[model samples]
Target: MELTQRIKQRLREVEDWNVVRDELETEAASHADKSEQSRALYDLARACESVFLDKAHAMTCYQQAFKCDQSNLTALRHAREIYQEMAHLEMVARLMGLELARNTDASIQPSLSYDFGMAMLNQRKIDEAKSHLEAAQSLEPSNERYSDRFQEVLYDRGKWQLGLENVMVQLRALTGSDDPLGSDVVKRGHPLSALFLRAARILQQESPDDPKLLPCLFKSLDADPSNDEAGYLAETILGNGGHLQHVQKLQDRRIANTDAPEAKLALMLAAANVWHVRLNKPEMADYFYHQALDLAFNEAIVDVGWGSDWFLAAYRRLAQGADESGNADSLVPLAERGMSMLGEVDCSILALSAGELAWKKFKDVDTARRFFSRAAKLAPDHPQVVAFRRAEGLDDEAKTTKLPAMAPEAEVLTRELPVADDDDAVDVRVDETPRRSTFVDPASAAEPEPTRTPEVDAEPEASPEPEPEPEPEPEPEPELDVEVE
Candidate 1:
């Protein structure tokens, strides 16, 4: 019997969809044509979905429908929707590809192609996504979303050079305007900064020292000076002499014009490099370094990988110079300031050095012990910390007792006793007598030896004169005189 005729007859026999559904299922089981079976299953799925609201049964029916007839658009659409919602992006992309192949009308091609491309993109199918997105953009050139998505795909595929070219095109359009800052591109999205940053990153990776990268970095900084990456790249380029004079001039101008803390900080840092490297002014260099450090603590300077290390090193140099000059007073303050700038963990070695200087030169055991203890807290088992602890008598084996001063006459003594010879058979008995203490009273002991002063010790020792030669032995000069005569 025809499946439709059976469904109709069953519908007339009973107004219940359950009866019609059961009859259709029986007929579908025995149906000869796969198409008829697919229709029956699809109808049953609709009935289950609309009447019973059973998504699982509807999904099963849709799958069966698609299996029976590959051309079943409705079934494919429903199944694809479910898969998409389930985040089965690969399956969604495949189904969309099939749908696109089925639909050939130009009116619907753009939407279908875009959907397929987005699905592929979600699945990380970059090449396929780019192809489809490009097609969609060409079909509808005015679609901003398509253009944006295509650009994203290009970037994802590591086509940074192409991305940079597109960015340059946009930048040119904006900069060509009478008021670039008020241009639509800037008002909509200052993609200029992001593009510059991306281009800079690509160039940096490809050839860090390339001259072209300097312009990109500078453009990025111009777009947004607060950009940490741009600042870092600019600093690196200028430091390496990439447009050094021009960048320094611009930085100086920006510093003079802008009161923004981040800008000032970056500019001051660059100025410091200029002073130290180009101008050869140590005083100005130190001044800028300190200014940058101060600004960093108070302001939100973007961390361009210059955090505390530079200042800490400068402080160390100063402290070391002072220590070498035997100016303990100056060394302590510098080291202490450095320790405060950098945490205890990073500056523990500085602390140890200061402790040693304090103890050895200043004889300030308390200060030395305090510094050592702080260092121990940071690195308990450090070699220097352990050595300092032991040297300061703070170790486990250290004794607390203090011995009294020795007496003046309590000196070391050496004596030898003679032994009897065994050759003579005679009695040789020697009496054993106890020795008396040789220590003398303090009042009777000679005056304590005077301590030697450096000036006195600096004097040269005196030496005896050389012996005079004998007059007769003074070479016979008379021999030559007699010959001349």
Candidate 2:
């Protein structure tokens, strides 16, 4: 019998769903030797729930069909949509996690698994969430999102748990030295070396009460503060009862010793992020924000012809941080300064930020609209600007504008910007580009070091020196004697 006809016949024979369900089950079982045919029968049975006049019966059949072929993408997608609308949230997480696990590429797994783990986490299935996230992380060991979440799961247990300590030890071992974040030392070259440092930071958080670990953690941060690990570690230490004196002393030392503007920028940013998030010290956060802006401004002015992405990035971070903390007054000046630095460049993002700051933080929609208008003009096609314009119920009269890329001729214009007399004597050559070198692997046994090689013995050749004049030797002693007198 056709699958649809069979389901219809069962529906006619029994008013009770149990009888209808049992009849459908028998039909499905008869086709069990043909898995594909059985799956089709199950699907047809599940589909009957809509017309069968029983909602609960439909759900059970749908679930059973899904169980027969867990890899059925079509069934999974439809089920998700229904469950999401019905608010049947329990199974959604497990299904999403399983689907992501089926992906073959390891690089992409972490992002997918992270989403799955988060859903499970929200459902309060902590153990399952940790397992899925760990599996994702194992596939992509360097991914920050997976590793960070996995550590967070470990942290949900008590602070003194040995499991957390063991993870820390494992991370520290990968670092490859006594250094808290071993191979993560800046010497590693890749930006992601910071991952190890972040792992170390998580360890510090797990052992917040241990005074012995606090200094070591800070010491490790001192070595590679630019990475996210240092920022995260610093935040945890500052927030969770570590000595503030230690943080300040270490920061001060870093600021004094490192002449690299990028390093200073990283330190300032880390300080700002840490104080704002962890300490709830808005005033301190503002201080670091101001410092970071000042440093970024100097870099832009010094290298105006180059990319200002770093400075722009810093500004965005500061603005976002301020917005989150409800510090509107602090955001305005910073945003304005950023706008000025940006000049005729597409200043739309800044405008949107200003509008947000005004409307949300200061409760001034009129001022916000004006800023939004400018942003709309600057970037009419931008999604954020368009959204804001719509929110204000503004008409769509705005037109997109094109801006010029930084031309090479702008170098002369940039050079015209004033430089301080006391600034470092290092020559600012427009032609000289910054060096970016990759890490060289250490020598293997097959590649012996020069010191390890036997030196060839050869006769030494020497040249005789001419006789030295002695007359000037007496005059030095005579001058010293006269000074004593």
Q: Which residue pairs collide in model 2, if any?
A: 175-182, 175-183, 198-229
- Tell me the lDDT of candidate 2: 0.47
TM-score against truth, every candidate: 0.28, 0.34
**Which candidate leads the pack in TM-score?**
2
- Over 300-365, each residue of candidate 1 has an lDDT whose tens digit, in order, gives 232333332344334333334433322235556545543433443434555666666677668887
Poorly placed runs, candidate 1 (over 4 Å): 1-33, 46-53, 101-107, 140-148, 154-485
The local distance difference test score of each candidate is: 0.50, 0.47
Per lDDT, the best of the predicted structures is 1
lDDT per residue, candidate 2, 117-156, as tens digits?
Answer: 7566645466677877898788888976577667657654
After the best TM-score superposition of candidate 2, give how far the Cα of residue 123 lies from its true spot, in angstroms. 16
- Per-candidate clashes, comma-separated: 0, 3
Query: Residue 276, candidate 2: how far off, in angstroms?
Result: 3.9
